[model samples]
Target: MKNGAFGRDLLVKALYGSFKKLNPLDLWHNPVMFSVELGAIVLTVEFVLEALGYKKGVLWFTGWTTFWLWLTVLLSNFAESLSEIRGKARAESLKSYKTAVMAKKLREPLPDSPYDTVSSTDLRKGDLVLVEEGDIIPGDGEIVEGAALVNEAAVTGESAPVIREAGSDRNAVIGGTKVVAGRIVVKITANPGETFLDKMIGMIETAKRRKTPNERALEVLLVSLTAIFLVVVLNFRVLSEYLVRTTGRGEPASITILMALFVCLAPTTIAALLPAIGIAGMDRLFRRNVVALSGRAIEAAGDVNVLLLDKTGTITLGNRMASEFIPVGNHTFEECVHTAMIASIADETPEGKSIMELAKKTLGVRSDALPKNVKVIPFTPETKMSGVEVDGHSYRKGAFSAVKEYILRIGGTLPPELERVVGRIAMSGATPLVVVKDKEVVGVVALKDVLKEGIKARLAKLRNMGIKSIMITGDNPLTASAIAKEAGVDDFVAEAKPEDKLNLVRDLQKQGYIVAMTGDGTNDAPALAQADVAVAMNAGTQAAREAANLIDLDSDPSKLLDIVEVGKSMLITRGALTTFSIANDIAKYFVIVPSAVSPIFPHLDKLNILRLEDPYVAVLSAVIFNALIIPALTPLALKGAFYRAVAPDKLFVYNLLIYGVGGVIAPFVAIKLIYHLIEFFVG
Candidate 1:
């Protein structure tokens, strides 16, 4: 019932728009419809003159024929107007997500800073705003400081509350979402009317999505067919006039009959509905919680051959945590864990926090250290070590080799037991970090990042689709290989640098593969830019988001599977309809052509195989069918034709026989049936 109302509203708009767009200059852009509009006008003039007795019975059916021609043009416009209405209505509802809110603009992005109240619309890019619990986030931005539990049901259509923290990949937040818990300072990324939802609304409302290469080629073919029909209509008229002049026929063919024949011959049925088909595809993607920058990207999703997946944060749960603490030397387990907990006290990473929690749970250790006078060295990707100094003693924890070398440099002897312990933990596919106090090796902390549930099944799905999933990580070869096998990916690149990932995309492209990459780090930005289809997580850095064409709002890399299916459906839908549309013209030709020319040459009546109706009725039936067919198939155009995951050659041949051959036969029965019904009603 709701769809019915929306359809009615669009028809009302098209009724008004039809008159507004009736001008010759405006109609010129649509050459196929412009021809029909011209024919309608010329025949209407002739019908008016004949009705005034200027000529007797010269255009007996011209008035009704002209009416049908005008209606035909209006139906085509109505199909487009109705297609846009679906997304337009959704856009209006999305505006509700942009609810009015007062933003507290910070003088600087920090707590306890001066702030001023302002409307969300007044917020500008790079401006910082403080959001408290239960307040709507003013605009699209990154959390510059603090953390919050955000309700994102309006955007991602999930009811779960997501944690957004500062200085992490998941820091970005959308406007109009509420901070259900905690507080955060956000630095706006987009101004008002420039948020992600706003961009999606604009793309859907405009409906001028960029066309893929195949769609462009199909358009050229349709236009060429229209041009050929234009010539056919003109020559048919010339022959009618020449025969009348030489043979002194009873009367020249009615201008209305010629107009009807032209409308039936052209492939205007598909042309009128093509834009609607593409718009429906985009709306489908948006409904699935994925935002595509353009229609071309969605089309590319259907053709992904090689999928390059990141290991951390993509295939596994990104929060790497400390699972077990093992004593390395002759030190007691509790003593080593107590010291490890103290060294990781100021650590903000998940690994650090989990270690503190574990120590408290097992040894009942209390955190009572002083906050001042502590020298700290943070971990860097290059150094791979972190340490703190209390008084004059240094406590450190890092990779086993880094700690072992530091202790050796301080004149400490190596322990044989430490090497065996490290090897056991490494073989288990967990990160082993050595905890040290001054020059003594104390213990090893096992950090494990668990793989997400059902990831192996997701990888298997991609493999069935002929997509090769390759895992790339900076982890050691053994760890990478173990994770690769566990995840069931086809290949793995161990200890791979950002440059290696970028080079892989280039090599894949050289081998004629459509390589698609998914990443969230700033280091992945360049490779994402070079990929055929780049999908950036919604929680990724701004650089990664800017570089990617598709943004996965759910942040599940496996969403790629759904995207590919939607894309294949879009392409298949268009192909199947185009086949049916052109083939439909063949049946209409047999219905109207013989009747059109039989009046000019009596012998041509034999070509009318069915011989079921008068020439006037047959022409009227065909014209009415042309106008009615647009609405008859409007649902199919918007919803798409039936699709299956079969090879293109198989799909083409299957559709050719079904839609192509069937389209030619079905319409003949319908047109004749319609004429017989009209004849009975008039009687």
Candidate 2:
């Protein structure tokens, strides 16, 4: 629909490229097309002899056959060249975004360290850079200190700002995105010309892209078919002689006519469009904001039957927001909300910020500024609790067990209903944070891990396509089971560690299952590497991204569905076109075979269903049709065939009827029409 890449300049360059590809050295890699080129060269030599008075009577026939044969070869080259040109144009557009900018290089990793200003291009790996509010990130790196809200619309095309903080899975930040709010000290992970963007650009523009396994296998099949056809056509020479000796009815077939029949019967249609199909598949993924590192990775996606998805960020929103504050024991709702808000005053995490917001929205309470003589306590994996000390009193909020142990150490006892409340919350797939004032339990804050919208339907669709969905999480069995049921996953792994995730992938692969893993953390790197098809979020750590075969620019865990669909579409398009190309030979056989040998065996006239008056006209018409079909189907090759989510058996039947049967009938009608039109104009 859009032809922006086909501007005047690009079209001229592509046209020149098409002719350059006609060189024998370039054509030799494609056996099917190489044979066609050889046929064209032989015909050209015959045409030259005819023009020089060696074969004076058949000059018109030799000249037209040679002309059409050359046209056919050029059309195939043009299809492949146009596809490459469009890919190069897209790579150029992406490269334009990598402009040099000045960065503040930090002398020390501290927040208050002195810095020097330098060009971002001059920065190297392990360099620490301080980026303040509204400052652009200078390089791809991990946040070493502080937290900030970053706008990554330049890379991910998402306008919403996402949080990047030190010591978290979401700390990784890409160069060129701006820090929309707050400040952060980043330790660069990549050197000049070695960033993620640089690698992506190289992949798109490289001329030495390796063929995927499927492409190589298909080429082998096409080559075999071409060889078989060559032997059959050559043996026709002997068969023609036998017919002449036995019946004494017609003359032996000439080399020119035999070559024409071979070219027409070979699967030239699919061979011409094969390269374009693979290139277009990669381009389609790029359009969807995914960068595939290799053609093999995208092809592997189509065969994936099991999906190992992280529970956080992929199935549920990563942030666990405070939804409700429930009073336990004799505490009132107002008191519980106020105490929870005070305990979270010094907490900078998303859960803490959410608690403060919820308190304000509920009771108009603000805890932006701490009181005099206040001491902030940050949450840690060991303590599992965070709170503030002010006015000689302690206020804290954390996991029920952690907070309970703390209260007991301080000579306090929990209310009888506290365990019941915490169990109920966990069973509902929401985390319960216990709030304490001094030595007394106040209430519980319910942090709900929200399920992403439309996730259930997406998982269901994957099921219908015969893919199993498994959710991985570190939550307890109660919480994990609730979330897994709500998300409609086929299975789940609860209380999973990094090693657990890695083992799952390895075990699935051993069972002959193609597993696709989606993650965005350093802990996920091993599993991502072990999986058959690994997709990492753009916002993930450098380790995870490097281990993945495909990177989702939008950082959406659910984007695997779209990636799978694109892969399936590519495979289906190739299969459908290959089937159609082979079926098309039935029509050409009817048109050319009977007409080519009709002079030797006149009784073969009954096989000429199209009823052409002249044999030379019929042969030329078939040549014209074969050459014209390549360009006619160029758009389909570039765009790929339409795909629907259904069982493989159902899709196979549908394609058989549409492409296979349609291929046979359509060519018969087209070649017949071309014959009459040629006769009317040239007779």
Candidate 3:
């Protein structure tokens, strides 16, 4: 839909939601508004009776009062409906990228038969599909063959084209992203209507934003306060009669007095604005290009004590590449470089590809002369090594510890000189991929990955929020420490395997900490599930995405800091509004109760500190002012109260001074002005 049409639809739907709010049963979701709404209903009946000239005089005018009461309820509903309207417009935009198209499916691997053309929806999981340079990826899949530069702008909102190749970590591809160069054979990972983008769109359309724990707890407190006010109003008759006997004044029991007192003292403002606050928070997250599986997860992030970050793909650029070739143990640099190339000949990692290129440039090794039918050992998180075997001669290169153990297993130990060289390289903060041939150490390939720029400042923000950050890596301790110190993380864990990552999360939780893990590797799946707040990359594997509660579409790990702020924004917004709501009641009681009953008592007129022109106008003005404030604060509720990172007590003190004092002062002035306006017009 166009912008104008979307806005028009929003107002219409808001009107409909307002009508639905009139039902008393619907008040269960908004109990604080229930008493005022029911009062408006009763006043509307009196309006009809007074108009018919039945059993009443012009003692009270009910028309404008009734109109103000109901308008308050409708304004609250409209604020919430408008928030969802934004989400609907975004969902429609996502749908445009998924228009139907024909996909070329491969039935056989051999180049013997023509490919079959099938509907995009007909492509099932595990089916192989061929996408040309300009074609959109048929489904969410893993690249199993060929390479391509794919544009992920539709899904991630990034315009840069990323290279995708078979048999590597960056192979995952999303449907609806365009292929910009080369062709790729993708093995579908998701079936029809089950793609990642589909789940994202479904989330927005439903937008079932559940109440955060803080929201729920505050609601219970508000309900209790409402009940207490109800009891106080009920017994005010008995309390007033005692005074009536002594003073010879005070009016008899009246329903209008009870209704006005209940509406004024009860916490209605925040209650009416709670749903709007929550929906707006979700919409804000969506605008940041983050999709939260549940609003609860976003809230949980607010209290996260420990942030667990992966070192490779998250903290660094994640492009581990060969930077230098260092030979050890009396071998020429050329011999070591040639042996490193052989070990990485069949390896497909970016690290492996860089090793091959480095060898050709410096050592003049020819790729065409490399041996064929060689056995390739793929790197695994468990083994932490990759190797090649040609006729019983094993050439390996990987993590230093893994390669060291391999040399010992074959009765050939790493020479002291070679081991010292490995230590020197690792101490330099570069990953030392040790190269070995025939169980003897040959050289070390220094794989360098730079830390992301401006990461330290982001980590500092998390620290101010009372969150401790730790970096976990499979690199040696010296390298991990070097990186951690430069990055300014709170702590670092070196040589961490997949299981070690899971154990760290479990231990932290056992000690009363909320953990948040960010990773893109399948190995991080278990750790992600174990953490309190699991964030996955959009370019990550499907398994990793399934394990995570939030997805960063930009694939930027630094977005976690922003997510923390968003979560805290929700809690702080609700808290400030709640404080303001209750505090405003203090002023309302002064205006409403004295104006309602002081005519008979005359002595109770002392409480009319504002010295209003007329008595009935004071009471009506307080009620109208209270009703009008709901819509007045709607913008603040939707935008969320201004938040700053501080300790809990300090945060409370700050909000208390600002909202509490302001709430009390604002209502008194507004009600007094409204009373003057009523005198000017109606008198």
* Candidate achieving the largest TM-score: 2
In candidate 2, stretches whose alpha carbon ends up further than 4 angstroms from where it belongs are 1-13, 99-154, 159-166, 171-191, 322-327, 330-349, 352-397, 406-413, 435-443
- Provide the TM-score for each candidate, comma-separated: 0.78, 0.88, 0.81
Report the alpha-carbon TM-score of model 3 versus the true structure. 0.81
Alpha-carbon runs more than 4 Å astray in model 1: 3-29, 55-60, 243-252, 311-468, 474-492, 599-607
Q: Write the per-residue lDDT of candidate 1 for residues 561-601, one digit (tens) a residue.
A: 67877777777778777777788888788778888777668
Spell out the clash pairs found in candidate 2: 250-600
- The local distance difference test score of model 1 is 0.80
* lDDT of model number 3: 0.82
At residue 523, what lDDT does model 2 achieve? 92
Q: Assess the local accuracy of residue 91 in candidate 2 as a C-alpha lDDT between 0 and 100.
A: 75
Write model 2 residue lDDT over 199-305, tens digit each, in one string: 87787886335798989999999999999999999899899999999989777777778888998999999999998888888888888999888788888898889
Q: Compose the digit string of candidate 3's lDDT tens values, residues 1-683.
A: 43552356666876786787678896668777777787778877877887788736343646666677788777767766677677877898899998767899998753233589998899999898888889989899988788899999998778999888877656789999999998888888998899888988898887777777787898889889988988998788777777677778745545555666777788878888988888888888888899998888888887788998888756788787788998888778887898899999998878899999988888766877788989988888887888899978888888888887778888987777876777787788887888988868888899877778777877876787788999998877988998898888999999999899999999999999989888777898999998889998877777788899998888777787788888888888888998899889988988877776686677777888888746567767887887889878877877778888777778889999999999999999999899888888876
Q: Per-model C-alpha lDDT, please?
A: 0.80, 0.88, 0.82
Clashing pairs in 1: none
Best by lDDT: 2
- Steric clash count of candidate 2: 1
Q: Global CA lDDT of candidate 2, please?
A: 0.88
